[model samples]
Target: MSNEQENPLLQYIFNNPEEFARNLTKIAENSGKALAAYLEPRESGRVQDETPEELSLAVKTLAQVGEYWMKDPARAIEAQTRLWTGYMHVWNNTLKRMAGEDSAPTITPAPGDKRFRDAEWEENQFFDFVKQMYLQTTQWAEHLVEGATDVDEHTRHKAAFYVRQITNAMAPSNFILTNPELLRETMTSNGENLVKGMEMLAEDIKAGNGEVKLRQSDPSSFEIGKNVANTPGKVIAQNDVCQLIQYEPQTEQVYKRPILVVPPWINKYYILDLNEEKSFIRWMVEQGHTVFVISWVNPDERQSQKSFEHYMQEGIFMALDTIQKTTQQSTVNAIGYCVGGTLLAIALAYMAKTGQKDRVATVTFLTTQVDFVHSGDLRVFVDEEQIKLLEDRMNKQGYLDGSKMATAFNMLRSNDLIWPYVINNYIRGKEPFPFDLLFWNSDATRLPAANHSFYLRNCYLTNNLAKGELEIDGIKIDLKDVEIPVYNLATREDHIAPAISVLEGSHCFGGPVEYVLAGSGHIAGVVNPPHKNKYQYWTNDGLHRDINDWLNTAEEHPGSWWPHWQEWITDKDNTLVKARKPGARRVKILEDAPGSYVKVRL
Candidate 1:
């Protein structure tokens, strides 16, 4: 179990011969050349004047090359294989001359020392490489042997793409030339222009002034100031198992219609309460809306046996009960983000199926999907075999580690995250930029083993929820029965939740659905508020007439929809009860703010 004894490369090679041969070849070549030229120290050994400098330069150059190879390794190994074989031949002749009478230095590979084993593994991998080449060559030869026929353009293009994929996988190359032209043509004609427009928009965002703005007409500024003032203060409220920690809002400005905020248990709630400058929670409170967000308990190995049913009962349902009690309201509006949204949808479906529709007034979803068939790239992580492997690992560990979930997200955007760091630190000799978001992103949380298994099998792999075949607690839930007004936001450029996959699919909700195509990625789009030079929103319904009209006609808005949303929510505010602090008899009090469970990391 010690780090020193752990051989990642050995483990990988033993498990995957094809990958080992494809990777070990490069490591072998560099070590071979470096070891071959190392002369034995002697009094008459004439060292060159610039020998040290030459070695230093070679070492530095090879190190730089190593960083580049790490990103697209298949090709690097192939090149390294060729280099190593050449070095081995030269080294053999040198050994013969150096050891005429005396024996040469023993260079036995023990499959544990990185240097010796690396070369040895590469030598063994050559047979695998030859076998793979023969198999592929045979597959390609079959097409030629049958005599090439005139194939349709579509079929030919598809064949060519597969041919290229296989060739790239086997032959490997450091420089990968992508044909974006084909991808461009596949997108809608207007989409091509939209991409260019987005680039300009991104440039504008990068160039925009970050100066603070003042609004004389806004009554909400005082409320936001109050929330900001209490940054280090503790605010806690509880009912049974549901606990609410208000680091900001302590008083109750119970809007006639309250909105429940459901964020993913995988992440902290502070994404909504990020900071005063970009806090959506603060913004909502200032806009005269009562917001209740769920703070999830971070499960440890001890809590690994907890299932999806437990999460629904203890997390979402418990929070809902507390919200109803605190507001003294029969129904409340609901908003769910990411995985929380998916969970909320399941809860809502369950509620409707069991005739509990009076609890929710309206539903709002942010980047959540019910169907997974159209989910892109993420599918690579969940093949049947990989899923089985993941489940087995989770069961062994008692829970799916949070760090593992974080790694998956990072890999989804590896070009933007992992590769840039590798290039900067390893190649360009630069340190990483310190960003709060990246820090928060790296702080991963674990999923209980039982919960993770159910999530993958029921929601993702099966897509049973949207199909109306999903049952929870013996209740056959249907989304169609949950017909409250709905607001669904989808980011145009979200890879995690593609626009077409969610926004277009909202038609299946069978409700008064209002779909908004926001102008950013998953996180940025949701976090964005109405600000100068930020971005605008387009709706399936008409332009900024009214919430009702906007939900009815497809129209484009030129600016932030923050003010419009504020107007819509406040239109139904009550004058009966002012914002008040709840007494012990009226509302239950819990632990200090941010709670014990919110701070758990792993």
Candidate 2:
């Protein structure tokens, strides 16, 4: 008992060995009595046979216990003690079950699960130690209940509450909270480190370069011509995200027909034209679609006065006006991504509500959500208190900081992007690898505090979008009122905008909604063109249907959904005409391919 004092449960088990042994004797006596009754059979045609070997074994067991039986007084005392101990064990176990807590199984103390003799030995020792401790504690608890001096209805209830409280106090959660070392290790591991290191690197780069890099116009990987800006037919349209260079045939000109690309102000529009290999915008240009992307101005403190109504008017509606005038086309195919998609949906709804849908011929939404309910975990950070705090902070600064927006995104993948780099670069003196995606991820945009707060509270927190209760510029917007041909793309692995949540948009839209499920997260899914490693999509029969029904018939395929999308768009427009420019009489060229608004710094 002294040696076992290090573990209280083990000490209890050791101190009660006699009582345990006595219980074994009692169980044996009960077994013998049952066997003797079985040996007696009523007079009938049926014969109950007892094996000689079994009868001999039972007789031998009874003979051994006969000595204890003769010492009746001592044996009776021991049996009573064992019964009390068993009762204690049952009571403790009942309390544990009610608490919904688990006693974790023992684990081997090694670097990994690799097996060796020492590992096996350690595993056995750990499990044995835990098992012994559990049995002793259970027995002690059971014994107390069985030996209660005053047992009545009220007393029993009081005892039960005490047992539960004791069980809870001794629960495993206490150990978890006290383990700071484990918490430190977990928070500092994996992708978290990369994000933190990338953040620092982004700051250094932004400080040195002043503005994020915009790739010069380039042709799609699938295009036959070179993507060089100086190339004969290399058409350049620069935005803050990147420079989209289009290579069209000498005969195929963009001065005739136009295609408008609308991206959310939250992110740069370059996702459509990330690079020649992966750029969807580049592919459309090569496929003879006159691509006109909206290069959103990166807002700053000066633009803090800009409101949601301004974004729709100056940002999207203005772009549409320019595209229409430049191309001399009455309507254009407008594709929006993320927040841009939400904006596009708003514009489409506005057009529908106003009894006007002619300017926009086709609309596509990439990972956009109309319903607030399925907005996923992004809702966590947009509660009333958080929104108010952000509004106050942003109002002071005029616009929400770009780096701050990036911080929120990195928090979503903290284990993958924040703390790991904090430990490696800040704590461990390690240099991070320069990854292109990380660089792109670090490039963020600013939003007006008033606008951002309104969006978070009205769209996400309140879910006014799907309810047809969303108001833009004092005008109630209803998506169902819109009769435009709509295309919605959702990614399966998008944590920011989950597929389940994004699908709500299809239901909210009154138009012919074609919802497609793409592969990968938000960015990769949309940027994925018809490349070898690209993923496939699932769609219904071009009719608006429930999400589950579409999934049931949806087969998984590989490569991007862009090709399928292009086919769908082409089918809507059967006539092939030369690409045209915005032919408005009074509109003047504002800037080069990419605009100045995208270049503003924090």
Best-fitting candidate, scored by TM-score: 2
What TM-score goes with each of the models? Answer: 0.60, 0.61
After superposing candidate 2 on the true structure, give the runs of residues whose Cα lies further than 4 Å from its correct spot: 1-257, 427-430, 542-549, 581-587
In Å, residue 508's CA in model 2 sits off its true spot by: 0.9
Candidate 2: worst 10 consecutive residues by lDDT?
215-224
Model 1 residue 25 lDDT score? 57
lDDT of 1 by residue, 1-602 (tens): 85324743232223344544543454345334333333322223532233354345334433443444455577456545645554554356345544553333223322332212222222323322332333335344234312223333323333333343334334211111111221122132322222332233332223222110111112223222233222322334543223564433434554666667788867766667655666777677666566667777666677677776766777777766766676677787788888788888888888886778788878888887776666544654554555686787777767776756765676566545544443333222233465445545654677888877877777667877778888777787887776877777877678777776675447657677767877778787777766654776776643242334444565667666556556544544444345533322265556544555555554
Cα deviation in Å at residue 296, candidate 1?
A: 1.3
Candidate 1 has an lDDT of 0.55
Which candidate comes out best when scored by lDDT?
2
Clashes of each: 8, 43
